[model samples]
Target chain A: MQRTPFYQKHLDAGAKMVDFAGWEMPIHYGSQLQEHKQVRSDAGMFDVSHMVVLDLQGAEAKPYLLKLLANNVDKLKESGKALYSCMLNEQGGVIDDLIVYYLSDTAYRIVVNAGTREKDLAWMRQQLQGFDATLTERSDLAMLAVQGPNARAKVFSLMPADEIAIAELLKPFYGAQIGSWFIARTGYTGEDGFEMMFPAEQAEKVWDALVGAGIPPIGLGARDTLRLEAGMNLYGTDMDETTSALTSGLGWTIAWEPANRDFIGRQALEAEKAVGVQQKFVGLVLEGKGVLRSHMKVTCEAGEGEITSGTFSPSLGLAIALARVPVACGEQCSIEIRGKLYPAKVVKPVFVRQGQSVLS
Target chain B: MSNVPANLKYADSHEWILDQGDGTVTIGITDHAQALLGDLVFVELPEVGAQLTAGDECGVVESVKAASDIYAPVSGEVIEINHALEDSPELVNSDPYAAGWIFKLKLDSTAELTGLLTANAYSELVAAEA
Candidate 1:
């Protein structure tokens, strides 16, 4: 199994290791619940080096990304701005969901899921046949995500004097290059923090510094619960190559304003839009005993749906799930768990945002 | 190192039984089992007065990672359940021996206790798995 630069650090911290997409990564240090609560209340760090980072350069980078992604790159007006978008196939099925950072007019940085790295790279290369864009995967870098209510303060307190000012000025969804590090004020845990990418060799030092500054190391176990509670869509679980963004709670990520611009899946998406989506993505909260899990059949007035991602929400003290139900389904539904049906309430897909409950 | 209480008898599947000196016994998952399952987020306990057979799945322990079945170590009718687990499932992780006991069962047959492993044997089983 492939190991990240911080694999030894994880072992030193008494982490339970698990294989995640070929990477031997930490599942948790001890109690995943405590680590989750720590991130929500104080500060926690995650070793996210397994995620792939690619640099797209050259004059055609702008045009290349516009046609390559379902979301228009033109929306990124300023440097250091980041946009979340889905790369689609001809059938409008999602290839991958990614974050693209507009570093400059000619250079852009994109981060894709680790599990889909090979396929995503191959797809991006195929799309670059005519464009002058050059995609370079950065293998010499390690990434860390420090997240929570006090995450920024904890991280900033450890930053060098010269880098502190620029780091403080970074707004959400924005990033900046400081010395050899690239720091972004964005996260997946619905909290304020920085996702920093630095030299792979310096990872241990930086991780030690962060831990010394009172940031606890979190494992992938809590990461899943945190993102699910935040109502974020996990790429493979929530949507995959067989799913479309419109039916996966990601309709807002698609940009279709420029009528003349023909993206890869424009025709297919337009056709689907014309016919109206058959299924709708919704969040569920179990009202009865039992935890809701993925693949559990959800029965509603309209028809049967299935949970794509479900988990017990530590913050809400209840089980929550994201499911794709019939578009006409109402607020109440029943989930079949272990041959028994349990009642659940339908609500907005986001359960929490900015560490606050979004559900009423 | 996993904690295997010397006073308890264990099933190969990791459930532990405590003989109460009456025709009754208390049951819960072993500490090793709880540690393997990670943090408990939700738990579904068998209802009081529910009949269960040996090796039958009677309850569920769910963590952020996954859900595991809590099997009945011996056959009997459940006389009582730890209702506190309904609201605070973490007890399974915090104190898997005393406060996390799933239920008390009126032992259908005392002979069934002979099939359980001793603390030393359970420790060996956990070591072999590791």
Candidate 2:
């Protein structure tokens, strides 16, 4: 199995290693629950080097991305600005959801999910036949995500004086190049932090620096719960090649304006929208006992649905899930677990933000 | 290595049983099983006086990560259950061998206990699995 640069560090910290997407990644240092609570209350860093980083460079980069992404890259007028988009197939099926950072007209950086790296690269390369755009996979880079309420301050403590100044000026969803590092104020855990990327060889030093600053290392187990509590979707569990962005709680990522953007999935998405989207992606909070889990059957007054991702929410102290239900589903629904149905409440997909519950 | 108490009989599925020498015995998941399941958030136990067959699923232990079925180590009637777990299931993770005991069972026959693995044998089983 492939191991990241911090694999040894993880072992030293008493991490429980598991096979994840062909990589030997840490599932948790010791206790997943306590690590999750630590991130929610303080700061924690994640070794996210397994994610693929691809740099797009060429004169046609702008035009290429406009046709490539469901979300328009034209909105990213400023350098270092990042836009989240779903790369879709001709049938509106989600190929992958990614964050693309616009550095210049001829240069942009795209980060894709680790599990879909090969497929995404192949698809993107196939689509670049006519365009001048060149895609370069930065396998030489290692990435770390420092997240939580105090994550920024903790990370900034470890930065150089000049880099700290540049990092401090970054706004949400923005990135900046400081020395050899690309630091972005973007995260998956619905917390304030920086996702920093540097040379793979420098990973141990960077990790040690963060540790010296009192940022505990977190594993993927807590990462899943943190993202789930924040109501974010997991790629494989929540949506995949068979599901469309319209039905994956990602409609906002699609830019329907410009009237004629002609993106890869435009025609299919427009057709589906014209017919009135059949399913709605929503959040569910169990009203009573039992933990809701993926693939569980769900029923409401409108129709039946299935949970894509579900877990016991560490923040909310209850079971929460993301599900795709019939568009006409109401506020209340029931989830079937182990042959028994349990009641749940339908709420906005966002359960928490900035370390606090936003559910009402 | 996980804690495998020297006096208890173990099931391959990771349940542990402490024979009280009377007809009644106390049972719970092994420490290795609890570690594999992570933090327990909820637990479902068999009703008191419910009959169980060896190897049949009698309850469930739900953790934050996933749910695991609790199999009956030996056939018996559940005489009592640890009700404290209903509100705080984490007792399973914190004290799986003691206070986290899921239920007490009255054995149908003493012959069944001999079929279980001894502590030394169960340790080898855990090591092999690991």
What candidate 2 gets wrong by more than 4 Å, as runs, is none
Candidate 1 wrongly placed segments (more than 4 Å): none
- Tens digit per residue, CA lDDT, model 2, A2-100: 999999999999999999999999999888889899899999999999999999999999999999999999999888999999999999999999999
Give the per-residue lDDT digits (tens) of candidate 1, residues A50-143: 9999999999999999899999999998889999999999999999999999998789999999999999999999999999879999999999
Position B100, candidate 2: lDDT: 97
Give the backbone clash total of model 1: 0
Instruction: Give the best candidate by DockQ.
Output: 2
Per-residue lDDT of B67 in model 2: 91
Candidate 2 chain A worst ten-residue window by lDDT:
A155-164
Query: Candidate 2: deviation at residue A206, Å?
Result: 0.7
* Model 1 interface CAPRI class: medium
**Clashing residue pairs for model 2:** none
